[model samples]
Target: MPAGYSLHDFSFDLRQHMAPANVWVTSGWTSVVAAPGTVCGVGGCFAPPYAAPDSSLSVTLEVDGRELRDGVRAGIAGFGLGLLTSGGTWRPDRIERSGTFHQYDDGRLVSLGVHSRLTPVHGAGGYVLEITVENRADRDAEISIHPRLSAGQPGRLPLADWGWMAPRAGDLVAAASTSMTLRHDLLHSRVPAGGRTRFTLAVELGEAVEPGEAARPGATEPDPADRARQATDRWARRLATALDAFPRLETDIPGLAAYWHRSIASGLVCLWDNPGFVTTPFVATSGVDGGALCAYVWDTGGYAPHLLTLMLGETATDLLEAMLKADLTKHYAIAPDGTGLGVAYAYSGWSLVTLATAVASQRGLARGLVERLHDAVAALDARFPAVGELRDYGTQHNLLEMRGAGWEHVVASPNAERAAYLDALATLAEASGAVLPVDALRATAHRIRASIADELWDAEAKWFRSRYPDGHTELTYSVQAFDALRAGACTPQMAADLIARVRPGAFLGAYGVSSVSAEDERHYELGDTDWSGGGAYTGEAPQLALTLWERGEAELAWTVLSRLLWMGEHYPYFPQEHYSDRPAAPPVGRRANIIAGLAGAEAILLGLVGVRPRPDGGLVISPPPAPGNVALRGLRFRGRSIDVECTPHGFSVTVDGRRIAPEGGAVVVPAA
Candidate 1:
């Protein structure tokens, strides 16, 4: 295969699929062991979870002494292999991708492909490459291939130490990536016209195999192809069971429906489930960037946990609660080993509380845990406080640090966030049947909400602005306002004024919502592509759409959501941030697999689907109006299976099997 092949070239779907090149298929767990489209080979991996990415072990192919260049197509599931005919018709069925496709030898077609499977969950051992040759002519094809694995630093092994492979008893050599190359495989295939034969090479890593106990790739041991398929099927089943049963999103939009599944797959890749790894269910920020192996509090603060809670239930809670091992009072992200990474970020405190509440209110958490989280927030409140008392949330960088330094802390969103979290926690505490101070927490929340309008409201601009340390209001427009709006910080008039500004050339852009208003030349000029000027934080696009929908801007919400469809159609998953096209600055965004696009699921569930778990152990489901026929099937909520469909008139909701027409789009499914 040519190095020019894109991610779309090797996509093979499992369970469900989309158009080829729309999704990437590889060995289940985020395909961590697989190559980056295999065009460059598997350089980036989540395995060994934190193994730093190095150069890729390159792969190439040839047939009858001539290099194969064209006529390659991806598998049906998107990861399998296929070839093209002279008439340009794609012939597909067998699997794997990358390497060369040699055209013909004396009018006989010869093609090569490999389906690879690496060291499974442990991430420590070797890998296997199934290199196959398909002869598409009347006479049998004779082939001899010797692939030397040469790199900057090839492990200086003695001739006796070289690993071996079979029917011709080949030798495997080590490269820079510790990759073993196939060599001296001179096998005259017994294949006839249109016949295909396999060359299964089993490789053992130098570090994984014992000197005397090493297994050799001798005489095609026990039909390896059949065994590989069975193992892959087992993996697929295990992964399907790892997550909670999610509601399938069916939509008229091209890739929107499949995006829901793709988003979940992205989250699956973030997990580091090696038996001996740090935590059993730990998650890294990116599936590809080996350097990013922590679950960022700021990212969790966004829509990640909301979707996680919805999908994995308390499992998601456990992963997040593990993050609390870090001294949250001073840091914002936590590694698998319990070390906090970033500085004391602005959103850490509430982000923790929000994570707790997402599960506490849904599946139910222990009373002791809920009480501890409440006290933790109280501690944060005492140290940081809200905008009214401290002029900031502990003077730390926030989600939108692009505006300016310390500017994140100066924002007015935390006050509302604090009030909202406290209210939810208070209710959660009561539900757990262990409440120490319900009235006090509610009273405090009430006071904070009142203070937001009294202190931060800019009557002149009819919006809210940050109160600088000097107690002067600075006029600015950014995505932060959307957070304040979600927290119920805006009055009817204030919300109308703030949301109306969400249009093109302002907060809203072609890609998504801008981090700051483009109209603010002075402030915007100071920012770059990392959620600042001329950049769209990829996660925010789906979220802004949800916010707009919830705030009753149905038409506008659809516009934003529709524009964000580019995410699923383009990349395998939503990236951290969408950089500007014009003479852009460096890609200063987080290593992806950030699970930012998870907000798309959140928007659908909470905003458009309008499924909210009430504090009183009931559900307030109000499916919002959507374009075309939209149905959410098999939604497992609070131990209840709920299916919701949007009709021309209101919505059709089903609990278990009986259908109920919500009077005003409000149906109360009692809490489990």
Candidate 2:
């Protein structure tokens, strides 16, 4: 980390790697650094979130001892580029123009400065950097600038953005842009009042190839005024790069904490925001829908806990309180016995159950929150009375009302959804340590498990089946194995068997878990254009595969996860409620369906790391050995710091600087 500069590059290169949320900057010449083979991925250049602007500097580069010629490389993309020009009074003609070859984009001028000069900057190259202005307007503009140069490219000349910043020989720019403070890049020195401010960009050669200093040299001798700005930039880049692995899953079977998170938070957000109205029975109350589920779910359960614990540990208590307040409570319908309407028996209850347990078990919620959750569980519990139960509501899987005399295989049947609810409750109880009505909740869970085993599992099919009023099993691959796994009702072997039947191509699509199995006659094309596929454009959100991975199907889980990620990238972040029956079988993109991105992101977090938070203030850290190199750098968990680097050899973990012995490559850290 440099002293006055707010940015530092991490060894990680996202351009070649696929990550959940990546930021990069690219120009005509500079793009080679992000080219396929040389670097990791294409989107390699990006700015930090906290990138700020500086008005006191400029940048220039010369390649191989020569004043680098122009047009050789792509134009530059700077992170702190627009911050200086953002404010009207910061400096009229905020950008200083210099250089014979400089030219600005035409007609893009603002009253204070030029409108076209407005270029946005994100944390690119781990630096809160900005480009020098190109003085588009006829009049020369005096621009203060800050810039950075790193070692991601080669055979390059001094590249410059003709229309943005003037190429300077050696000037320092600010680290980031903000309202109150501004600091200059260490490399930049004040420029004279002229159009051509120049600064020589330098690079570390062969001898300095390795990191020479253990601690940052800049940290000790920081100027009082500029210290915070630089420090903030350094921290931002480290955190951004450090948390990259968790979001970018290289394999299947999420990290333990990530899995639970996908199940709870990501699950809740998706279910609440599901756009597949009438049939699927979930909708976004109000949020970005075009994303993935696992990420959203994991955010609630896994990432939220893990990151908050690591960085914002003390805020956990308050965050949980806020979460409880934001969540909505709705009544599906009420029976004569006062049991509120329940989701006939599907995946929705899993969200509620997961939340209840997470709140009670992890956060140590008081009696009020616990009791409220318990009451909901009790009412939900009552909705599924033994197996022969009946009610006037005729099976309401919430307010969606499953009204059909024929065997539609609606969720209204108690067996499936009921079991899911029980699974959630058990998880809550187990997580909370003290069960709500200890024996009663456990008893309810046991009964639900038994009912699922007796009524839902079809021996001939050798798998759990969806049910109808006639008691005929639909035998679809939607929620059966998943809910059973969640309820602790299925054996590992049973889960493995279910996985074998539902391969990604058969039952999974690019967007998410598919609704109908590829082998089924009604596969994707079957059913009505609107109210079919159980509201899912294809079928209900695929829960079967999701649960299998959560339970420990790493290899199998990755296969499904890859399909979902493919969908997210192409679909503009549609939450995969179901697959489209269109001849080509595309995904249904909706505003409320961002769960696709969420789930994909979550899979990387949960499956790879296997982070699970116990009822007691403790965490279970498990990493799966998968397809390729997996490295989880700065994973903050429960006041403990875990840095996981996975290579060809095996997994290595360091908790608070202590080498943790791998328990079969998995480690547990007691909570603070």
Candidate 3:
């Protein structure tokens, strides 16, 4: 371990030989490659953008006339350190390596510290290779410095002027479509005993134009080290601020604390701020530069509440606005061109209303913003068709139908979500002071609730069923029915029945609650990529867990939430979906997925801490009566910082460091 380094740091290590070590600049333009047989570039060296090329960037080092090419070990460190080893059979137990990824506030700059040390032997000495790659806002340049280094070309370089010069030679302009390869014999430097050297490689895509040029004015390029330090400090401040603003939960469960801390940090990183695109500044579904770069409406909405807790109201607002801007009222996915695509799923609109209400209720949205959202909600609600006498809306498929509906039958889950959305609309209307048909909305919500109890509830099966247009029903067990619990559509007995089915070997699995019953034959056959049959879509798990907690099933809710947190430990960050059987395996879809990350982080505050925001702008701190004593601190509400400490005796609260007596001996405070 090194200074400013901890195991909790999000990192990926290259355990095998010649494994690909890729690093992406924060600008999302350049990828620094250190893998064997690859060409390392700063700017357009790789693809135009997105990720590094398939070919590896090659580097050969020479020390004291001895060429160190084979059996050499190298690693690319980002946000943390990971050392790489040569593909040959060579093992040196005396060498220690570490590194850290640093991101600057400019959104176009990032750096990493690649450090190594050789243990003292009878005649052994110290050696250091300091490698730093910085994306310059100025002209394009690729600078690589090693101890008398000779570079080899393992693959064909794209047409670009190429040449070998002194390690400290000045910048040279190259012609387009020019290519050159430097031999290892062109090195003449060496490292003396107890000596250290710094290597710098920079590649700038001078041709890359700044998107929305007006958005970035007077951008100044700083030294890599200074930028790195500034990035480190900024991240530190962010984490500290998050801890101070959100409630903290410490439990006796193993690995829970570390997961809590990492989720908060990782959630912030998922926010992308690139301009020129509709999804710019929107939260990405995954950290991957490839297919997972786009944002999903359902996923963004799932994570918005947790973002509010962290005082990231702007990010939540941006995401919702992006979706509406793409016309989510009629589309399932928002295209990069700001156009909506695919038929609007029922859950997507429901998510919009839900997230809108949360943001407005938390005062995260301005009155004008709320007005826009109210209009979007009204538009989305108008798209739903009246399918039955109940006037309850339906979807072609539920959230589980990621690809498409296997059966075009009316589903209970979407109707339940619609009920919740109607409630949210009423709340948002009241909060935003916007003119809305509140009485009609409430009456419609009541009809939907009653219809859920009469038409969807399977009294004999003791669960909700997906009814078809022909009056037939699919009696398969689905965790989605729990949405009714959150929508206030379930009866006391129905809620008890749903709670009982959430146990392990049924709907619950090792990782989290399964989408379908584990005992179902179709559970194992669901499509691996999206929500299909039985696997747990990490984004939806927490909603059910939160509902369970609110419905007085705190123990069962904790069981689901803790399992999801535990599973999140395996990924560098939280992922989109995890298979029920392969709980510890890497996610089947995107890595560093934001939806699940946001949802999981929110579970800590909404489920464990019980920090629910009221429509009247007041705060409520009513943690469940679980066995463990809980302490929630730094909850921001009505411009005041609140803290709550719970014990067997009762809970004590402090607002802005002043002790406040609870109303009726419970932690309840009026709106500031």
Candidate 4:
């Protein structure tokens, strides 16, 4: 009865408000149909794949005063039935051979009878329905109905379009995203003697339609595109369900909001699947479910804090403590003099910086924890004293380890900058106005920054290079270079030069920057075994663009952001990783993918106008400086309802009807 309410939410056919149109197919497969019960003994139904047996079934329904639009079709794909994209072929797993439909209305009340079942593979949700017939006669009853879900655009490919697709031969993506919706109808069959027929279809329990609300009219058919978009709304409900699976986080509500808000803030950095993992916190794009089992992680130390710091401040402290306990024993088996070890192990140390900083921020220097953190920082400085790129740590347990090994360390390392960035942990040491060992960490960070500028910066190459034991630099521009810029350790010219070098090749692909520079031959290696291994290795392009923008490269950053989104629109769904070479690889799974994580988080939390808690107990409404025509309307922030209009002229914020002072340079309001 309300906007955005669905049968899954209110047990009613909210489709009643949709506009009338043609049959449609979403992404492909899922179908909806509409029909009148007056003569055809038919009503309406939403159908999905059935379970147990190999056939599809309609979840039956009956409505009163409901305009049953024609039948429609749709599809669902990508990570846990979320991340839906329009256009695809949906072949019937199987069709129901026999079924029944009936409708009866007693003034204000209505009843509908139907039976059907269908099954879909890899589909978790299932559908169910049962009805009894009293008549002893059988007849061929033709249900007058239209397939609202199978409709196409004014000029679009038909449902059978995929029949012509070449399997992975080339891009199987549609020419463009389709815009459509779905409507469904009742299924009919025979009347048997005192017998009841039971039917089942795959469906989420939350989306089941209520018996009484089934026939209430006003359901209209939309194109397939509209329907696919509708399916994505199901993700939040699914997220709620998935949350039920996890034990309630042991943290206060305010703390919990802070934690989620931190994650939400990180999401603003990029709109790709980099469910931030490793040391850097949420990568704005590359991260997933916290803890060790995250997807494609690198530098978890830098990635983890981005997720924990803003919220659950105490919990963040606990997380750091936990990592110290778990990782120290496994990843940091280094000797005191930092000698005789075959390789370098830094992920634990990198992450420890985030942990120590988080703890010091909350508890201050008086807590003995600061000493332990200082000790850890001291160890890191002692271990990788030279400040070159780090190597992959090693393999431990089931997941790939990040213990920084031998000469292998020079390749694909996230060292130096990560360590320097993590050294910001020292700032928390000043919490009590007491001098801390923080200065030691700051000095170490400064040393690494200076070393990078002196040795790693290749003036001829115009970017930072990976220094190797062979005394040759890997002449390539790296996002790791951007990390140094973000650390505020790089000089302005260095940052500008880094941006200049990144504009060429895969680093500036159709999406955003690639983790590996395109000019480097080793960037696209495919293998069953290697440190980088296979699967999704490249970072989402939007993330690199965001880093550039954050570093003040606005125009070039916008160019990359637009291209990455454009590439996203062409995929099966917003992939966790896109092929730097092929923009249309039927996106990989969504676990720990930063792109989806960042995009979804940004759309709701930041693009909608973000709220961050300031140390002084107020909120900061810093809207993202996203390129293109970015706007935030109906944004709700602390102390007032507000909206932000951003342009090249900078940003302006309005609260209620009054323009507030952004004069503070950042929008700060007292904490709620």
TM-scores, one per candidate: 0.79, 0.51, 0.74, 0.51
Off by over 4 Å in 3: 1-56, 65-189, 210-244, 247-252, 277-280, 308-311, 335-337, 364-372, 389-399, 402-408, 470-472, 522-530, 586-592, 626-629, 647-650
Q: What lDDT would each prediction earn against the true structure?
A: 0.56, 0.35, 0.50, 0.34
List runs of model 1 lying over 4 Å from the truth: 1-40, 44-46, 49-52, 65-95, 98-127, 148-191, 201-231, 385-391, 394-399, 403-406, 471-473, 525-527, 579-590
Which 10 successive residues of model 3 have the least lDDT summed?
118-127
- List CA RMSD, all candidates: 8.7, 16.2, 11.5, 15.8
Candidate 3, 1-672: lDDT as tens digits: 012222234343333221133222222222122333222211112211212223223334332222333222353432222222322111111122343233342344333233432111110010111242332223232333343322211122221111111111122333342222221221233333333344532222222234433112235533333433343443445444434455555566566665665465446555443443454444545443333445566765655454543445445566677777866556665543345655656667677777676766565456566667667766776676567633334543434553443223555666777777777777676777767777887788888888879887889889777665567666766666777677788889988888888877887777666776766554334564334545666666777778877787777888877776655344444555666545643322334244456676677676666777776677777777654676666666657877766654566778899987766635667766
Tens digits of per-residue lDDT for model 2, 1-672: 112111221111222222222122211001111111111112122111111111112233321122322112344522212222221110000111112233233343321111111111111112122223233344444343323333222111111111112112222132222111123444333333333332222111111111322113234423322322443443444334323323222333333223333322222222211111121212222132111111122123322233322222333343333333322233322211122222233223344445444444334555555555556545544554334432122333332222322223333233444444554555555555434565565566566566656655666666666565566545554433454465466556665666676554555544444444555543233443222232242212323334555777766665655444333222222332434322123223232222222444334555555656665566666756655676555455444556666654567767777888877556777757
lDDT of 4 by residue, 1-672 (tens): 012212122111112211112111111122222121111111112121111111222222222224232122232321112111111111112111122223232333222233222221111122222122223223222222222122221122221121111112122222333222222323343434443333222222112233332211234423222333334443333223212211111212122222222223223222111111222221222311111112111233344333234333333454454344332423332111111112335445555665455344333334455556655555554554343423322232212231232212342234454545446555655543434566766776676567656766667766666555655544543445565565565677777776776665645555344555555564433331112212223233444544655555656755654554433222211334444444433222222223232332232233223334332234566655534333344433223455556644466666666777785556766535
Using lDDT, rank the candidates from best to worst. 1, 3, 2, 4
Residue 648 in candidate 2 has what lDDT? Answer: 42
Residue 406 CA error for candidate 1 (Å)?
7.2
List where candidate 4 sits over 4 angstroms from the true fold. Answer: 1-198, 201-324, 328-413, 432-436, 470-473, 504-506, 521-540, 567-574, 586-596, 599-629, 633-643, 654-658, 664-672
Of 1 and 4, the candidate ranking higher by lDDT: 1
Score residue 614 of candidate 4 by CA lDDT. Answer: 32
- lDDT winner: 1
